[model samples]
Target: MSLDDIRGIPTIELPYETIPVTEASAGIQRILSLAYMLVWMQSENLITAQLFGRSPARQLIFLMDETEAHLHPRWQRSILPAILTVLKELELIIDIQLFITTHSPLVLASVEPLFDQEKDKLFLFELNDNQVTLNEITWAKQGDVIGWLTSEVFGLKQARSQEAEQAIEAAQAWMRKDDMNQFPENLRTKEKIHQQLLKLLPGHDPFFPRWIVRMEADD
Candidate 1:
């Protein structure tokens, strides 16, 4: 068929009609692109063995960088699981190894159920004392996205805004009666810190009760 033929590029069938892969949304396009690449690899493996009288590939190594870059949070939560499912369904006659790097906590949380301590590993890139090091992290399951965000993998203190985090830290320091010099001048006093906390934290914030009880006791 000519390059412009309907079969030239992959298409998705919709309820009303078929649409070219190029017409799909960015998220869909990214997913379809990955599927096409893996399918092509499988096809090449089979073809080389049959037509060229060569041994089929014994393994495939797939490397993906920031795999969740363009994906929405909803998709990010499921994409890793879906990819693993697809890989299993492909049933290729070769072992497949996947190397993926992602910044999304949802991506890491999604794999919690599928993580194998024996077969899978987690590594962190750290900059220490002007030297860069790659450290192998012992895998531990963080129940949800928030857990992953605050876990060592992401190193987030509160998974909150910078202002809110600072306010919280200041509150914690005040409660512990720590040295006020360590905090911003505005956050050093109970009244000022309370106002800052009120402005930054929502009513339902967990930090509220702790601060409120202390404030009420001192009054």
Candidate 2:
């Protein structure tokens, strides 16, 4: 039978039910992975506490592949902060060893802020054509990383250039034209005209870009 049919079976009865079906499904795999991670981590912590009458110091090795695949860029920004909180919480009882592989620049940028200069805890490795290069980054505090990323490492600051303003304005003008109905009586014709207007005008921004310039002046 297919995996979905198998997933409906309870874990205690079936031999193959030990693996979570939620993890097998591609759509919800990330969520399932996170769930399994939490469950196993907590279970281990519980066992350690019971054995020692208090949680014993234990090292955790966590491996994650393409960790940001299911996350939005904005949401990806929170990953490091969440990891820090988890580490802090676990530090009271156990030691943690985190290992992750990611293709997302945002994910890399997120961790840049967490580097400790005095501790010398941050190391970055870049791989290309089967060759790996290592780089060390040191920061006095987490906030210093934002400047580092904006400065040389990722060049995120270049995205703030003045050319983005012109592009935004052109896109807004196009959207305004698209909203007008040339033949309001004929739905199909009006739609065609609207589509044509959209194609002719800037398609990037649906709203007028001029508003941005005005806002800048007011500020």
Candidate 3:
């Protein structure tokens, strides 16, 4: 009915369809939330009308920063698909150009079926050698979200925590060492390797079985 409690912006009274209801959401229940709602609600109406009308500059471009931000997993998965579906609903088949940046593996995995190598381009943003860089990723179906997290795009070796990855890397480094044939020249060297392995790796880790086999084989 009235407006108040705006932190930074000027608040205004706006009308909503205030029909009698048994329940109301926490968001729409408050004046502050209502003010925020009117802003975005009007923004979507105004921006679309201004940009996508029948004019010579008819090409539409959307630059979405962190497209998966504030979205639930299900919504993150459906976002790109929903956009394409909306395009199909339109009378004119306008070529919509979307440049979206996201860190969500779910967002990346969701588009596997719809990604066209010829039409859609994928780039992996990275910081290598203290410089920001973009690398073109060759399109490949990872089949699952976990695979996408571990793929070159995400640059995760095992989709694990920092400590776990370090342990795995240490184990791998041991395997790659040329001293596999001469793993231990003495009891001291053998004990050092044993302590290092146990310190870095958990006994129940899947890497253990193969590691034990390989160590015994070396001995």
Best by lDDT: 1
lDDT of each: 0.87, 0.54, 0.65
| Alpha-carbon runs more than 4 Å astray in model 2 | 1-28, 45-57, 108-114, 127-130, 139-219
RMSD (CA, angstroms), candidate 2: 11.8
Candidate 3 residue runs with Cα over 4 Å from true position: 1-57, 91-93, 128-131, 176-206, 215-219
Model 1: pairs clashing at backbone N, Cα or C within 3 Å: none
TM-score of 2: 0.46
Whole-model alpha-carbon lDDT for candidate 2: 0.54
Candidate 3 or 2, higher TM-score: 3
Tens digits of per-residue lDDT, candidate 2, 80-159, equal: 56766776786666666666666556666677656555553544676768999776544423244345456434546433
Q: How accurate is candidate 1 locally (lDDT)?
A: 0.87
Sort by TM-score, top down from the best: 1, 3, 2
Segments of candidate 1 deviating more than 4 angstroms: 1-19
Superposed on all Cα atoms, the candidates' RMSDs to the truth, in angstroms, are 3.1, 11.8, 8.2
At residue 63, give the lDDT of candidate 2.
68
